[model samples]
Each structure stands twice: as structure tokens, then as C-alpha cells.
Target: MTGADEALARDALRCGELTILGRIRSASNTTFLCEAAWSDRIVHCVYKPVAGEQPLWDFPDGTLAGREVGSYLVSAALGWNIVPHTIIREGPAGPGMLQLWVDQPGDTDDTEPDGPDLVDICPPGSVPPGYLSVLRAYDYAGNDVTLVHADDPRLRRMAVFDVIVNNADRKGGHILAGVDGRVYGVDHGVSLHVQDKLRTVLWGWAGKPIDDETLESIADLGEQLAGPLAEQLREHITPAEVAALRRRVRTLLAEPVMPGPDRHRPIPWPAF
Candidate 1:
């Protein structure tokens, strides 16, 4: 993270309707899952506001600033159906960004045939299944993707939009497959990489030809990017940053079946 990123994070945190849920110990940066008040609805939110400087992890280029910019751009440009809202909150220390949280789907039944955490891909957990089930509850795949995809092409567009955004952590759990079958992506704290930092399992479409609807969406985005959407992003990111994002959009529109991580490439360790 750079100085600009810190400043942006501080600004976002200081101004939203956010209530901290708790600190997430697994992330490298200071992260908190919170609740965001958006209009009449209160949505689950995630905040990653750092109090002090942290080492930069650049395999995924772009600062935290870039990720924030990417989030705003995706929503405005693609209407990817990513949760349509935001909450900027203030901490005793400084500001933080708040994202609309999608409620976790599935029975969440704590009992009955629970499985290993999505991250625990191994020869079955050696310990009692309880430990594995507990851990896997929040793991990827715990949420149901099929239900969300049931009604909307928007869900798939969001997945593709994430690929274009270079989101490195679109884990299964990050996607909320609502009872209404609407899908929302969360934990976009890592996105807008200048490099190929995209490490997601949605590559089920990798190597496949891009569909027409997907291509038109990309085109639609290009038209919108030059308008009000671009102006909105101008407030938080520099003109250069915004331009780079536009360039990325152009690239995606040009080559629908863009290259992603190599088919069998290993997942990047510690996604956030």
C-alpha cells in the first residue's frame, strides 16, 4: 500500500454508516467485517482500514487506491449487479471504506453432513469432522453459486467483470447467492492489479469463447466510462489512474476471451 492508498482508506472509513463486526485475523492488513446502512436496508460490509504503514504486496499491482477505484468503476460501468451501495466509516484512528455485504446463503445449519472448509482441500480432515466443519463453514463453496445464477445473466457478468478487474479473491464465500437467487460479490479489497494477480476459480469459462451478451456489456461499459462514471471516479483516483482503468476496459472489449491465470497455476497464497 502507498501513501495515497492510506489516505483514501482513511477517507472512506471516516465517512460511512459502518459498525465494525470484528477484526479478521487471517488477513495481512487490518480488516473488519461490518454492517452498512444503505437507504432503507442494512447490508453486511467489510472494511480494511490500516492504522499504520504495511509492506506492499505487488504481484497484484495497483495500490489499495486502485482496488477502491476498481470497485466504483465496476458498479457504474457494468452494473455487474455487485451490491449497489457503499458506507464510509470513521474509526478512532482514521477513515475506512465500507462495501455492501451480501448475506451468506444456504441453511448454515451448524449440523448435518457438514464439510471441510473450502480452503482445506486434502485427504479429509484428520481430526474430528467438527473441527473441519466449523472451519469450512465460511470457506468457499459453503455458499450456493447455482441458486444465484438461476435467474440472472448479471451474475455471470459480475464474474467476468471480476476477471477484468483482476480481483484476486473472488472466493466462493465472497459471492452471496441470495434466496432470491441474486448474487453479490464481497471482499473486493484486492483488485485492479496492473499485473496478472487474478486468482479465482470462476475460470470455468477460461479458454472458452466469450458470448455476445458479455461482449456487448463490455462495449456498454466503454461508452459509459467516458461519461458520468469517469467523473465520479475522478474524485477519488488520479486522472492517470482512471485512464489506466479505461485502457483496461478497452482491452477487455477488444479481446473478449482474454488470458487469465494458466489453467493449472497454483492459487496465490494469502489472497487479501
Candidate 2:
């Protein structure tokens, strides 16, 4: 969607009357698939209520809904549209997060035969030509498999965004290949912690030099965080978390290199 269209959609999500359609059973939290209507516009969205949030030992301060919105704000500031248009509003279950639903390329089977798989597991030594190998392990059937993700620029941008947000749960399923030909990332409820909690399956570009354009975007993001964006983020995360976010941006600017996995658990469980 164009910038204007995205703005309109965000407004719709903010003002629309929400009706819970059904429960997204696959989600760990109590999430609902809902329809939002405002004026003459209608859109599908996901709603996650704070009351249903499962408490985490590490991130015990803010609500997950707020963190999701915070992640969207950072993505919007970067002008990458990596996260879908998202907002916080009262829903059928009280206050919660509402995000525009992105249609994936293969919504039925989660496989796009005519398109590239942004992240996948395949037999050893069968990584796609343009894909990067991440891990080698044995599947449940005792067969050797390799975890890999496509070496696409859009996905690379998302990896950088994950770093800026300190996203702790960027599972393979969280990366969506939208039918609009844009790659989008979802499920940011576990992001923006005060500590370095980055975890993801997209370790393909680890230690590589970030491109010039992305560095420019990160620089712009740092400027935004110092001004209005910082104030906006404070509504969701703590002052310390926002300051840590600024430090992460500045550190990346100084280093200009992607970081490799440094934690004991660098990738999330059930990679897909």
C-alpha cells in the first residue's frame, strides 16, 4: 500500500468499531481475529488483550499490547512498513492491540510454490542458491535437516529492525511473505526489553556489513527517538527501555556490522 493508504488504514484501525470474529487458536495468548469497521471502510485485524497476556519472568514491567504498538511505531518511523499498521484500542475484551492483517502468499498451506520461502527447514546440503544456512540439526524423525532463510533484501531489513527493537521471539512463522510482494514481520509482543534479548531464526546476515541506505534509516530513527518518537514510546515502554533502544541504534551506527548470536539461546524454540 502507498503511504497515504497506510495512513488511512492506521486511522481506520484506531477509530473503527471492532467485532470479535473468532479465536486464533494457534496463538499462545488469547488472540482474536476481528473485523474493524469505520465510516465506509472495513478491515481484518488481530486483537490481543492485556488481560490475556502470559507473564514473562524477564519482561515483567509493561503490557504486551503496549510493546506490540511500540514495535509498530519504531517500524513506522524507519519508513520500512515492516510491521503492519497497528494501534491500541478498547476491544471486545477491553483494552488490547489491533493490527491490520497481512495476506500471505500462501494462506492455505503455508507454502508458496511459485515464490521464495523466506524461512524454511530442508534436507542437509539442499539450501537454496540465494538462501543462507542458519543451523544443522536432526528433525524428530532422526533425519538431518538444515534451518535456512532467504537472502532477500526485505528480510535483511527486518533482521535489522529486530535488532533495533530487541525482539525476543522472532520465530520463522513471524516472518510473512505478504501477497502484496512485501515482506512483513509480526508477533512483537516480546520485544523492546531493557536488556539484550534479541532472538530469531534470521541469523543469515550475522556479522555482515549493513548497507548504507539502512544505516541512513537507522540514523534517522535515532533522531526520531530523541524527539516525538521517544515521548510516544514512553507511553508503552519504560524510560530505561527507550534509552536502551537509542543506545542500540547508536551502537549499530558506530559498528555498522550485524551482530552474531551471543546468548545461550539465540534462536527461539520450534523455529517454524
Each candidate's clash count:
13, 0
Best by TM-score: 2
Global lDDT of model 2: 0.92
Q: How close is candidate 1 to the true structure, as a TM-score?
A: 0.65
Report RMSD for candidate 1.
9.4
Model 2: residues >4 Å from true position, as ranges?
A: 2-4, 108-112
Best by lDDT: 2
- State the weakest 10-residue window (summed lDDT) of model 2: 108-117
lDDT string for model 1 (116-218, tens) is 3322333223433322211221236455221111213544566577766767776655656554556666666666655556766454444556688778877
Instruction: For residues 1-272, write the lDDT of model 2, one tens digit per residue.
Output: 77777776777789988888999999999999998888887878999999899998888989999999999999999999999988888999999999999987567676746644789888888887889999998888999999999999999999999999999999999998787899999999999998899999999999999999999999999999989999999999999999999999999999999999988999998887
Residue pairs in collision within model 2: none
Cα RMSD, each candidate: 9.4, 1.7
lDDT of model 2 at residue 206?
97
